[model samples]
Every structure is written in C-alpha cells, then in structure tokens.
Target: MSTQSQPSQSVLTEEESWELLAGQKIGRLATSVAGEPEIFPVSFEVSGERIFLRTKPGTKLAEVTISPRVAFEADEIGDDAAWSVVVKGRAQVLEREEDLAEARGTGLVSYLEDGKTVWIRITPSDVSGRRLVPGDQR
Candidate 1:
C-alpha cells in the first residue's frame, strides 16, 4: 500500500489569514506592564478591522489604558501544521459603560481568572500571518 504525503501550505493569503482570525474564538493579547512584556490568552470576537478582548479590571487593564500601544497575536499548531498571526497597534480600554457591559456579556475569560467586564480594543497598524503545512517545509 502506498500513502501520499499530506500537502502543506507555507504562506496563508491575506484574506485566508484574516478569515481564520475572524472565525476563531480565542487568541493571545501581548502587552507590557511595569516594563515587563506580558501575554494573556483571551477569548475574542473580531468586528471589521478591530479585535476585541474582554478582561476584568486588573494591572493589565491599567497598563493597556495607560500605554495604548501593544501587540496581539494568535496561533494554531498541529503535528505538521503551524500558523501564527500578529497584530501591532495601539490598544484602548472601553470608555463607555454600555460598551463594557456588552463586551463582558460575550463571555471572554482572561488570565486574571475572570471574564473582562471592560473590553480592550486593539487597532492593528500591521497585521500578518503565516502557515506551515506539511509539504512546503518551513
């Protein structure tokens, strides 16, 4: 019996990559607080060009609000398949109470151990993604 090697895709198209991010539910939000880089896995919902991550009031919250600039990323890896996307831009905490309540209702749990009652918005300046399939090699 002969078996064919699974085909691999090394690079994902911009549309394909964005679609993956949009359809996904969970991702990691990376930021710096107290001069230390921090990464927190978060449940997200994407709308248009903006990515929304909900987290409760915490140190990260204060960091994002104060810093406003950050990086957010997401990735999926398989035995032979790996993909990652990164977002570089400014992040801002929701100011309106109504928006906060609505975002919290979506059920996004953060590393802080509780869902975000206030949503953090990341307006990506640059967004890119790559995929490593079985065949194309790295």
Candidate 2:
C-alpha cells in the first residue's frame, strides 16, 4: 500500500499578500458604473500600502470617478503551484502636485504607446490572498 497527500490551499497573510502584489506588474481592476461591473487589465506599481497605475481619459477613469470603490486582483500560476491576491478599496485620481510627483517617481510606464498620463492611486481597505500547492495525480 502507498500513502499520498492531496493538494492543499492556504490563506496568505497580509504581508505575504503585499509581497506577491509588489512582485507583479500586471493586474485586473474591477469597477462598477451604475451597477454595471467592468474589469480592465493594467500595469501597476506598489508603494507602501498603496497601489498606483497610469491611465488615459477613458472608461476606466470615468468609472473610477463615478464609483470610487473598486477591486484589484493579481495572480501567478505554475505547474506545481498557484497564488492569487485580491485588494478591495477606494481609488482616486492623483490631483495634488505632491501626489502626482510621487506617483511619477514610481517609474510606472503604461504598456500602451501613448496617452497614459493620469495617475490613479488605490488605497486598500482589505487585502487577501490564497496559495494552492498541487499534488501528484498520477
């Protein structure tokens, strides 16, 4: 007879979640406009407890302005393991000069060719993550 352990899932700590989030440059931003939900792929940077991303005048910006509450998610998957992080909080456009300067200092560049001139900051009220380790199936 042989004994085997099944795959397991674990909840990540807040620090672990932040570490994972900081390592990834791409994430999905979920926003709602009059109860209509939309998600957008964005390139972002983590600074302290805040997340920053650049965007142009578009639906994403418009939605954020309309509904400041949003959600951001990032994840990594591999053959052996996978992890995901979710951040729920309020987002705002960087309007103050000091804030704009700080955001510019993050060196965050948009994947788009041009027009990503607006900086939005996400201040997370809740952050959570999960990690999954796969077991042998064969």
State which candidate has the highest lDDT: 2
TM-score of each: 0.75, 0.94
Candidate 2, pairs of clashing residues: none
State each model's CA lDDT, in order. Answer: 0.76, 0.94
Please give, for residues 1-138, the per-residue lDDT of candidate 2 as tens digits.
545568899999999999999899999999999889999999999998799999999899999999999999999999999999999999999999999988988888777747788899999999999999987766
User: Highest TM-score among the candidates is held by which one?
Assistant: 2
Instruction: Show the lowest summed lDDT stretch of 10 residues, model 2.
Output: 106-115
After superposition, the stretches of candidate 2 with alpha carbons farther than 4 Å from their true spots are: 1-5
**Pairing residues by index, what is the TM-score of model 2?**
0.94
**Prediction 1 TM-score vs. true:** 0.75
lDDT of 2 at 96: 100
